[model samples]
Target: MGKLLLFLSLLPVSGLAGEPVALSEKTYDPSLGVLIIQVNWGRTWKCGQFEHAQLQALTFTQLPLEGANSVVLELQTHSQIAAENTFLPYAYVVQPGEYQLTDFDVAVAKSKKEVIHLKGAKEDMAKAPQSAGTFTIQPGEIVYVGHFGLDCTEEPFLWRFYIEGRSEFESYIAGFRQKFPFVKEVPVQFKLFSTQRFGNPYALENPTVH
Candidate 1:
């Protein structure tokens, strides 16, 4: 467990496969399954394109498992986005059961600067990363549902997070595994409606991959 957390703490393994793959046919543990909620930086939306700031911090709260409540999950990034794709592994190890993900927040900073939390009523036209959702994991099934894409280039800057479910999501998992070899190969069970937003603007669109 410590080793997995250590691997996730570091950001961007520094390379990507020439072509993305949809990892659909993978095996899972018969007694234990894994859940990965990855936050992508350095690839799309010119994240960290023109600034020294990188996505150094991220956190989520209120993840209720069998007997756990408000279990906080966090990840950190250290690599600067210099025209590269950095995948920060924000994975959580949980028992097979129903879980609710909510109260998500993110922070970006340069070296030695104070981190800022971005979960509030006001901050952008749409608070995509602060989205919430529910999911179920069987005893022998692994799932992938949470994903957030930070776009620093846009006006007012925002997190284009989504509930990915399709080939693209599978491709992301394949890319993630390639970038971080520490991640074990597990079957992906992505749900289309497993992700939704919290707070306002409440009418924002929840994106999904097909």
Candidate 2:
């Protein structure tokens, strides 16, 4: 636990935002980078399971002498997207730098009336080791950051999660392109850790900042 405490100490006193905003602008400062990730949480969202899951936020902790300050990225759940799919891409503009796609928090429901907190240790939650989550981004680049999902099982409070390389889902790719045309033209990068998200499938107007 000493290591974990030390790591937490390194975090900035204040987070970037209380709630992360979705990508609305097609155009941003070319001087920065955009990091993207998607979560597939179909299993947990179906409602018959003992545990339910909700993503808190994603974190990018800057590497010393190698990158900018840490960034906390929030997301609009899949239910909010106009597209018809379980996948949700959380795109955020960030400062170009090296970072570790560290851990995140999940509010897990143990039962109809009981909820639990599933937090920390991405290495444990993801199939990939700690090293896979480390990556770098440069000015004007768009990074993929991998695609992952959560697998709900019969076990209570226990989830099967995975992390992997870029997403190859054609429909998702198309949605990404339509939403951010210029971003697609720029070569994309990947920095997401060995993956992993859930929900009603809340429908809302798309956050298209075109």
Candidate 3:
């Protein structure tokens, strides 16, 4: 059987000038047990005068094996940019027998036919043991995915999405349902850290600007 796909709507890059960016709306079909996330950056939107900007979409999937008590899934995505890309810091935890699914896609207005490709790590988690410490999840508990988006200087936008569920596997589904209830919410704290700039070789070489 093919893997289950979860669709997280294209979350717009907030804090852009006065123009409000509209993100793609997400839908989940409980009957099919499939979740769909899509985001549209719209056309002719300029990130900066000098920057070649475009809209990108990404999807991730998490799943648990039937016989195993633990669940893990390989993470990957397709983007609209070339060279390389980097994602913000994020973390997730599931029940003992639950699993997760994530997918990524990006769309740029520059080319109608070709889309930039966003790459994902082959491993189940984004952070290594040294970076991501051990996480504990209780049985029949559900915790949605936690993501942090940072800019060139590792300044957090303080945006977060949460999922609620009793079983670790069902947390994502629950979180999807909460989108309507938790509308127009922002993070309380913003922290600044230094990290490499995403998708830019120059930023990686010089960590000082991050």
TM-score to native of every candidate shown: 0.47, 0.55, 0.29
- In candidate 3, which residue ranges exceed 4 Å CA deviation? 1-44, 47-114, 123-136, 147-210
| Candidate order by decreasing TM-score | 2, 1, 3
- Candidate 2 TM-score, true structure as reference: 0.55
Stronger candidate by TM-score (2 vs 3): 2
- On lDDT, the leading prediction is 2
Model 3 error, position 194 (Å)? 17
Native-to-model Cα distance after best TM-score fit, residue 64 in candidate 2, in Å:
3.5
> Better model by lDDT, 1 or 3?
1
lDDT of 2: 0.45
Taking the tens digit of each residue's C-alpha lDDT, what string does model 2 give over 16-121?
4422234446435577776666554333554336545654444545544233444544332344223232444466667677655556555566666887755656
User: Which ranges in model 1 have alpha carbons more than 4 Å from their true place?
Assistant: 1-29, 41-54, 61-71, 79-85, 89-92, 102-116, 120-131, 151-186, 198-210
Q: Which scores higher on lDDT, 1 or 2?
A: 2
Best by TM-score: 2
- Looking at model 3, residue 201 earns an lDDT score of 15
Where is model 2 more than 4 Å wrong at Cα? 1-27, 40-51, 65-68, 75-85, 121-132, 153-172, 190-210
How accurate locally, in lDDT, is each candidate? 0.42, 0.45, 0.27
